[model samples]
Target chain A: MQLVDKDQVSKSLGGRLIRNNIMKFLFLLCTLVGLVVLVTLIVDTVLDGWNYLTWDFLTSFSSSRPENAGVYGAIIGSIWLMAVTAPVSIILSVGTAMYLEEYAPENRLTDFIKINISNLAGVPSVVFGLLGLTIFVRQLALGNSVLAAGLTLSLMILPVIVVSSQEAIRSVPSTVREASVGMGATKWQTVSRIILPAAIPGIITGIILALSRAIGETAPLVVLGVPVSLLVTPNSALDTFQALPMQIYNWVKMPQEEFQYLTAAGIIILLIILFLMNSVAIYIRNKFSKRY
Target chain B: MTDSQLKEDKNMGTEMGTEIGTEVKQADNASGIIESGQPVFQAKDFNLWYADNHALQNINLTFSENEISAIIGPSGCGKSTFIKALNRMVELVPIVRTEGHILYRGDNIFDKKMTVEELRTKVGMVFQNPNPFPKSIYDNVAYGARVHGIKKKKILDQIVEKSLRGAAIWDEVKDRLNQNAYGLSGGQQQRVCIARALAIEPDVILMDEPTSALDPISTTKIEDLIQQLSKDYSIVVVTHNMQQAARVSDKTAFFYQGYVVEHDDTSAIFENPKDKRTEDYVSGRFG
Candidate 1:
């Protein structure tokens, strides 16, 4: 070979080095920006409400006057909403996921259903609220009660549950299915005994995350006509409810400075509850993951 | 030749079945005095297709009770498909189509009156890789029993212990019964799978390369377990490892390109093969 050009090789190597450096710089910049934004949001929330967070603020109920406002009713309402919504959403989501992943044939109709589910997942929360109002409250004649709100929330979170449960069910190795079938287990037996147990942790984690979203939602609840203030805890599904976010929205909109402080207190409490739920979900995931 | 080489040649001979006819002739002479009963399972003119691609072509075989029958073949020879068809496991695939009858104790398993679930309970299976359920070790072994309606705790406990013992894994895993099954080693998991199958109290146990995923030691252990298991239950094992077949099985069937080229007593098939294709396959000339 006519003496390989050393100069060209060196030049190309230098160019490659420069390009690599620029690519690394861009990656670092993006990561730093993301971390800064996340930290800023957390810090702002903490600084705004640090002083207002107290035990009495947490334990007391709501009041008509902004000065005496507490989150007891709102907290209870959130708890009740979660208790009702989570089970319904989970059952519907997991069932849908199982039917789609395991039983449903690969056809145009099923494919269409799957595509619509993903699209529904992207639909705005307010749209879900509107759907709930029309379907559950008006058409179903359930009224603007906790039951209606819960049903609405259940529908709102259904897509999340389905997607997560599908992923969980899908993650179970094909070898497991083959082994079960090889062992002479019926399809249903294999699903219930093997696939479901392996996927339970993932389903639970999805439910927790979806419930967190449901807890913080305000636009949908507003559309459901959940009351801004409620003195008594809801005793039945038909009773009007006030969620933490709605209560905070009511408190923050008040002209009084004390109410703004109370709003911060409410925000802190909601964050703590969400944090606890997330932690429990993480714990369950870790525990089951080890077993799997 | 070394012991290993001798063992290899013996395996190669079994796979080829060049001497199977002679071996069967000798066996006939020796066993002419003894009376044999009906086979546990009889498949007559069994044919299977996967959407027009014939997977199994005119397979006819019968498996005896309390005997180990080994199916040896190169990859994609329809050995697995044939075994799956016995218990209606292949029906799960929408594309799979079958013709002919698989009779189990005088009743056609494919009859409309017979359910796939009922057939499966009678014919349990173990797989190539160990697949324990994501449950406690005790629960993993107890699952089959529980499914068949053994609800009492003490009864389930006894079944679990007995099945584990049957699979030769009870002593190793007895203390850690409550531990998650995933924590067990690969060999233990495979044994646990065997125990799970045993807990169902099936009449026949189907094994598809049950030791292919394990180390040599584990393979030996599983082979021993299989030999022991055949004393009580009919076993039909599919193995790519020729030595494994000679080591454990009483009868050997050599399959080539989806056809059973030769089948006879293990000693005869190994000592003198009857088919050139099987001989070539056993000699590592071609799959």
Candidate 2:
């Protein structure tokens, strides 16, 4: 044979091209599948709940009559829960991440700790609920109140926040760290000034996701014996509460057809609140991200 | 200096020692020259190990105050390691272990009482690649002083101006002080890094192949700046490019396989190196 087989090579190239085209089409389908389902669900809910969703539905509390029912108590109770959860979890998770990434020695122990932290993220939320029940509800005598429930949710998301924050901290370039340290700045100064600023976008993204998860979690609150529906809005962290997901879950369990419409309306409202919260977080992330 | 080297190499090392031994001739600090008699860094039989690998072996070199000293070496030859050791920047690597001493102003750099940050304050460093913090040009220059506790805006502005001027990039960046430093070209960014180092006013500035990443024109600008900065600060620069070392350094140290083959006046080292390896290296015989 000559140096190359021209006919066979062209045939193989054509076959490879067809295979790549087929794979490209398949990948597009994979990418759009999730978006397709999400849009379908939202459209169906909006169509079913459009008429029922109103200021009245948001202003009142649960009632025997579907038309008179609302999610005011649930909404306010969720707010109280998050208010307690956000600051406590953020401070704890970011501090842990900082210590692990910057100060911890590179050894078997730190690796073990890191692996366990990521594992904790995969642990069931109900287990955290039981932990909260033991520590906050029974032992600490906080009862089935907002503080106990919020802490339980915080615990559920702690591993997620810590792991993500650690990743953000790690993503900071070693070159920047060297430059800072080379300038005679202490380790703490380098971290606070250079690394934190560069990593802020990633850290903020982690916090936003964790907080959103905290807002929607029902299992931990359920394990803590949180009510399915609250007639009165919680005024403080020590008071009883119900989150949006728990409220929606309660409405779905109701037998009345009128309550079905109410459930869809409540979902829309929850989605709106989540949307608003994410918008603010995204804005902050964009502001800080531009510098790096 | 350690066991197993060529016998002729040891004799030349002691002969070179006499020149360094009598180099304590300059004492004044406010001006240039890296004057003799004041050894900013003296490595006496200094050896460094990264875990099991002997990275630098029995290094005996003296960098005088106010002089521009160049270390020329091939890859893995330990020039970078030696300069990093001068400021204890090598301590960042946890696996590193050292024997003997690299002294700065008569104090061993590894002395427990003297912290790394304190040593770094007196000895700033510029890396091979330009690395500017993700901040405004003004903020980048002012950062060293700011971290050291200079907060007043007026003083910071002055220091920033002085530093940029020192690095000779003030005219290019003066109008864009608020712009992000990453917006600058490679040469400008390197100058900003130099300015950032100058803000601290260190006694000795260690540069690891400062112009290896730049174009020829930019490299020339940096070489000129190095010569200019030598008037006030002692600088030890490591470069693989023989021409760069020849053009900028007053004294040249030739490193090969983790050992200094020769350390002598730049003219002598280039013209009549005693070691065959050095002569071969400078003559393009083999790196």
Candidate 3:
């Protein structure tokens, strides 16, 4: 007699569906809010910076008069800083990740160390600036040179690289490792040939992301007492340097309208560098990342 | 029995005919030695533990050279663990500990002088799942040789072709050797895994349910490959399928609750198992 009865079940099911749709719409609204803000910022920057962004402006040295001012020194200094930061951060992060994932025995000490690294990633970048000031800048006597700033930025971004790299390395299937070791591959051989290759895409992506963050960082360099305006570009790791973000920060604070344009231009250049870095990393990942 | 059954029976008896052909092979030295020649692997009182759990207890068995020995057991009975222990791959687990000696060519495999790397080179393994590397088929096959320092392109190419042929997958995959291994069907990938194992030229091949993940047709193909391979290399296979163990292996080892219930010629084990547990398990009773 109740075979065709659908009233109670259908009512509850329809109610649940309505509730689910409402929640989905709410989440979508939240996502759109963030996207809208990002789009507005990008559009505003492009509009403001279009006229000031030029090869001449990029190639000329900083000037007290906004008309002749260029980010040439800051651009070169950023390049030099990146040259030091990239290799150092990648080597240290990948090594630390490999050690924790492959070599270190699972124990309370390792667990504690892992937890500390994760927590360090969430620590404010300004704290690392202070650490650099106390350790590299003052204690080691490296001074406020490019090396000190680079090392400081490296310390600031190291946790991000290490955490992401660890995730990548950990995500590599154990079956591949077992297959390699089963074939009599030594530990180092397995790491170099099998594990490293499998994890390269993730490692490269993480490195680029970390470097991009470091490139745009100004707090640590500012705390390190890097000059707001440098006329000459840095040549060596030890040479004092200025980054694009620092230039942008200095220009944005000036009361002049032309300096405000320079700020947007600097922001656009930094965005381009970040975009290029990410695009190259994405291309490499797509080309080399195996589905398995 | 059918004609094919008779042929398989004769094939099974070839190893046991000389010694213990009529008698049951005892657990230790008495039956370990084959009158024909030395065994490829001889396990004596092999016990393993994961922390406090006794995974394998006193696993005493011998795998003859150029013969397929299948291990059959229910789930969680240490069949896979016992297979992994052959190549010392079980040590990957943090809490795993082992006792007793496994001898390969009359040498103690666990001796300090013989490294795990050396032991692994002699014992190649195929997993329960078809686990070819994510690289191209050619690269997957040549991975073992490359790790062993073989760098000559000509030699690697020849080895790859020969291994693919040996695993009976050359005809199917020869044209696509450069293709990624993951692009192939499950059966094709399994064959590639076997090809990879063959390329290493190990003395013993440990297969942990090589066909468990395959369909019936693919399973038959792998079983045929296993049969053909036994003429040149010793194979120790672990399987959950009793019928597969009966069909593919010369001898079947029955494990229950971390112990070897019985290990004998497949015919003997299936027809009249000495242990009650082995009979019940083989008969599809309680696992």
Candidate 4:
């Protein structure tokens, strides 16, 4: 055999080495950035408010004086908003998902609807707030109350809920449908009994995640003119409301150091609530997935 | 063996012809023993199409009340299509169309008076793969009964137990009725599907390669169960396994390229086939 050339071997080896080095560097850079962001958020939040996060701060009602103020009203408002939004959003979203995933035929109109839904998911939260201000708040005559805010947020998160629920319903095997239909069950019966039950875990997880996002939203509520402070909780749809994000917003704008501290404490509570919701969603997904 | 036996055999042949054209079979015992009366279904000049492709061509056959009739053919031979047509199941496919007369208990099943749902209740079908719903075993069997409006707990429990026993899986799954059916073995799941079908108490049961997805032992168990089940319900099975067809069926219909090459008693079809193609296929000459 002829002797191999040194230059050719070196060139091939060098090319491979350079390519691998570039890939490794890119991967490491991405990992570093991700880790840095995660650590920074956690460390900054802890350092900013850990000492002030107490039961008294959590349970006490809000006050005009920075030293005495708490997040009770905002917490209650957030709870009420979620309670109202969850059921309404789930009903509308799951129903739409079922119709689209199961019954809707392939057509241009459906395709248009699907594309618009994805676009709506990407639409800015503030834009939704603007729309709510003009439509639900003014035209529809619903004032800056929990009902108006809840409805606005429901529309904002509706796309996410529908998309996620559709994925869940679509994931159920077609064999299950055939089995039910072959057994002489009606279309409605099969959907309700077999398809709905199998898809419940997925739907619940999606609803929780979507609701968590809705709970954190502030711009739409502000645009809808939700109150900055309220001693008594709103009892009806027409009464004005103030939520967690609005409370945080209001406190952060104040010039006093005490109000700043209170805002940070509220931020901690908000993060904990989000973390809890995400964990519950993850648990449900794991539980249902194990059965399949 | 004897002169009297020879004469009886001749008489039986003539009697067989008159009975064959009329009554299909009725279940009697563990064997697929046909009682020469009571035809359950009759198909005359049946044809089917999936869009433009011709699937089944001029099929004429009869299924007895309590006998297992096996439809054996090569791939794409339309055995499954024919079975689906019997229950109007082919309608599920958007492009599927059929031109045929399938008479069930002397009623034209394709008539406006006969709804697909009503026809399905009288004739149940089991697919090739075992597909138990993502529910408890008891619920899997009880699903059909509940759809038909049986709600009392005691009544549902009785129906579930009876169906499981009929499908020959009661002894294995009875202790774990509350457990999810998806956790079971493939063979057990197939039996659960069979039990689900049986829960409706249909007059006829159609199985599409019910044992193809099973292990040898499981296949044997299902074969034995099929033989036992023929005592109460008529079974029309489509299988690729020749031995399964010969073992479980009293009558065998050999289909080739969407045509019925031969239809006769299982022994005759296997041992002394009237058609050369059937002889070649059964003797392993060609598919």
Candidate 5:
């Protein structure tokens, strides 16, 4: 019952080892390619924009004079956009996901809708901006206000949140559902009590990610015709406002060299916000995962 | 009997031997087959289909109150399906359709007047795998009570304690009621699930291979618990292990190919099955 002698085994293992090592090295090289580019960009941005990240630079608004330019208005505007976007998108997406997964009848029509939603997630983000431009801005007459931009970006990330929420809801064990129903729990009781609690961690994580994507997006707001810069912070949702990515985009286009540094600083600011949101997501997921 | 004897019996044209059992059976239309207790649930000409496939056909059986009824069959033989049908939980499947009536306490369960929630409150189930919800042990046991709208903490505490004690796991889990149910061992989790079902104070308990996932000691523990619980509630267990059915049940129903081949007193069905198929299944012959 010996398949091979020890020496032959070792010889063949050595040959297999060569193939394994080659593949391993190739994967590592591919990984490092992305890593190296990201690190270089971050390091270069830090170095180029280090002097521009002053308190005065942060406190003031964007100026024609490059040295006095700051992202204060853009920061406030991004917050406003998110304030409108987060609640509207999370509610709509989660509700849609719940309906489709829980209440919808099983048929080709539902299947068609589910497939089209997934396809919509891959559709270009700017198309959603045009959709918002037509619906919210023109038809609804909301203007190019923060409401218009917020609704636009919300539409863009709607599919992403819907997909993630559906996945979270779907991941709840059927056994748990059976147990609940077997206990004489009504369908609503089972969903609200068992299914929702289990799915909240995943749904929250999805919402945070979708919000993160919305915050960093520039093209949709740009197409919505949000001002490149604003003088004052938005006092209401309907007020005209600037956003972090839009500010950076405008700065990058300016000929002044300092505006280039300002763009790098804006990227750093945006990254910090994203990193914070993602950290919260991971924390919530880990905490809830341990409880179950 | 030997193969030649069986062949000769077949040639003599006895139709599967269901007609001539030693005693009056559930399969018979006689209303007084059960000797002592009243039948809590009965399936009269019950049939079920999963879309075009007939999954259960003309199932007739009676489960009496304050007794344990065992449904024994091989895999995919509709044992679990029949048990689930008792509580109307089988309707959850999208393609499932059923014909004929399953009577619960002499009321037709398929009648539109019997809401699913009302029906389930009287019949609870424990699954093959231990499915403890991702919540506190107290919450897990209290789940059924809470669903019925008992929100008082004092009442919930009493119910939780009673249910855990009823399932015979209070000693192991009493100290950790605040802890997560998932933190327990597999056997304890199954007990917790049982406790959860018990919290509803159901009239009938349906268990689908409740101990198939457990060790020998755990299985024995649950078997003892089932015996004790039967004094209060009617029980139906679907099991692949014939020995477990014989050990734990008062009545045993043998199912094959979605038909109830034989149902009688536990001893009689095991020792003197009239159906050729039932004898073959019980004696380690081909299922």
Candidate 6:
């Protein structure tokens, strides 16, 4: 009746305890690596850029003289690009996700599309820039304008937005849809009223995260050939633009050591944008999660 | 029964003893079958398949007006599937296919003219778990009306009040109508779901284990509510709990492996089921 004989030597609990402690310590060390790196980077940036991070630095235009250089034009250009990119990417991705989740029939074609979309999310951002060069910049003749850059960035992040939005849509319980349909709601009605509202928190969070990625991305804009040091802000989508990351990249490669301080300030600005975006996402998630 | 037929029944003004929860069995003693008058839904040799697997087999059952019909079976006995078939909701599954006819008000639901939306409008459903929309209690009840294009705020409020009252949770939720439905207890949420189904004014409501997830007190409240609602609305419920079927249903259908083993008055089904399987199931020897 005994599962284990009393004489049987149990797998050494003391050895297991030591193994567990070692594994826990290893994980703690791994976490500390990331934390230490992040804290050090932030501290270094602050120490290097504190003098350059002034109100005047934010308001003034970029200059050949590092002391007078500012990110005014880059900030406005980033904002303008986002105005187009955010709406375009959110609308297109949500629509694609809805179609794939709700309307698309279960078939080989749909399966192929799903797999392609997931794979596309992992594609290099530089490749999307190349695609933009061929399509938006040359074939469409949009030139090196904010419109072209926004479209290119939108394309680059579309797969990520789609994948996350699909996840959001999937999380809306099938029971909710069933209840809607059982009450005579049409397909569109169910999607718009029940599914969309329930999934909005998740969708918005995904969108904000995607926007953060798009905002920090330098390689794609570099390949798109956005101006790195424009003095004038882009007032229209058709106007030439420069982004914070592009400006930082230009400054980092410059000969003057002071430009490195400007580069650090630009990184700080980029981090601020990232923090604000993530904060908004967290707020939305918390407010809506309480309801459901 | 057609819409006009329903109107005629309404005109009868509850004169017949069968108008409410009072049992009026139309029994052929020789055949030992108790058929109620004025059938609301009639499934004739209905069969359903999910891909190659047959899920419901030759289902021939009639649900009469103003009565609660309970479908009792073990897990995976196709009871839920059968209830979903009433509103043509089973078609939502891509692999599902059906043969024969399910007649709702004397017309085959599979007919080209009878749209699924229309069928569902006449026959609403409440799921096992309370699935109120993540919205205000008022909005959750008003959702069905809004989906049917009733948008006036005044009308929506009125419908919401009437539906919550119909579900017998109006007093408890009246002050908190604007609050999120999810903030309410599980029982209250289920009542909200019931009120939501009531808002569309469906003649028949299909309930798939509506109280299975609730506490005993909530279950009792819902059972009492169901008994009262059956005075006006025909209800078809699927329950794993036999005692619930006994407490709430006027008629019971015993399902086993996708077949209706026995269908009769609740008393006969529980007291003296003809089928050996039904007897064993009712006696708790086996499902």
Report the number of the highest-DockQ candidate: 3
Can you give the TM-score per candidate against the true fold?
0.85, 0.92, 0.92, 0.85, 0.92, 0.90
What DockQ values do the models have?
Answer: 0.40, 0.53, 0.72, 0.44, 0.59, 0.60
Docking class of 1: acceptable
Show the lowest summed lDDT stretch of 10 residues, model 5 chain A. A283-292
Candidate 6's DockQ: 0.60
Off by over 4 Å in 5: A1-10, A290-292, B1-34
Ten-residue segment with the worst summed lDDT in candidate 2 chain A? Answer: A283-292
A139-235: candidate 1 lDDT, tens digit per residue: 9998878889998999998998898898999999877787676555667988998898889899889989998899999989999888887778889
Task: Report lDDT (Cα) of residue B164, candidate 4.
Answer: 97
- List clashing residue pairs in candidate 2: B23-B37, B24-B37, B25-B36, B25-B37, B26-B36, B32-B231, B33-B66, B34-B65, B34-B66, B34-B67
Off by over 4 Å in 6: A1-11, B1-35
lDDT of 6 by residue, A1-292 (tens): 9877655445566688899999999999999999999999999998998888999889978889988899998898899989989999999999999999999999899999999999999999999999998899999999989999999999989999999999999999898899888899999999998888888888899999999999989888888889887778877899888888888888999999989988988899999999999999999988876344
Report the lDDT tens digits of candidate 2 across residue range B19-114.
432232121112223346488899999999999999999999998888888999788999999999988888889899999988899999888988
Alpha-carbon RMSD of each model = 5.0, 8.0, 6.4, 8.8, 7.1, 8.9
Q: Kindly report which residue pairs in candidate 6 clash with one another.
A: B1-B105
lDDT of 5 by residue, B107-136 (tens): 999999999899999998999999998999
The runs of at least 3 residues in candidate 3 whose Cα sits more than 4 Å from the true structure, single-residue gaps closed, are A1-5, A12-20, B1-36
Model 6 in CAPRI terms: which quality? Answer: medium
Listed for each candidate, the true contacts retained, as a fraction, are 0.53, 0.76, 0.88, 0.67, 0.90, 0.94
lDDT of 1 at A153: 92
Model 2 DockQ class: medium
True contacts kept of 5: 0.90
Give the B-chain TM-score of model 2: 0.88
Give candidate 6's error at residue A185 in angstroms: 1.2
lDDT of 3 by residue, A130-233 (tens): 99999999999988888998888888888899999999899899998998899999999989988899899998898898899999998888889888887787
> In model 4, which regions exceed 4 Å deviation?
A1-29, A59-65, A106-108, A255-258, A287-290, B1-36, B272-277
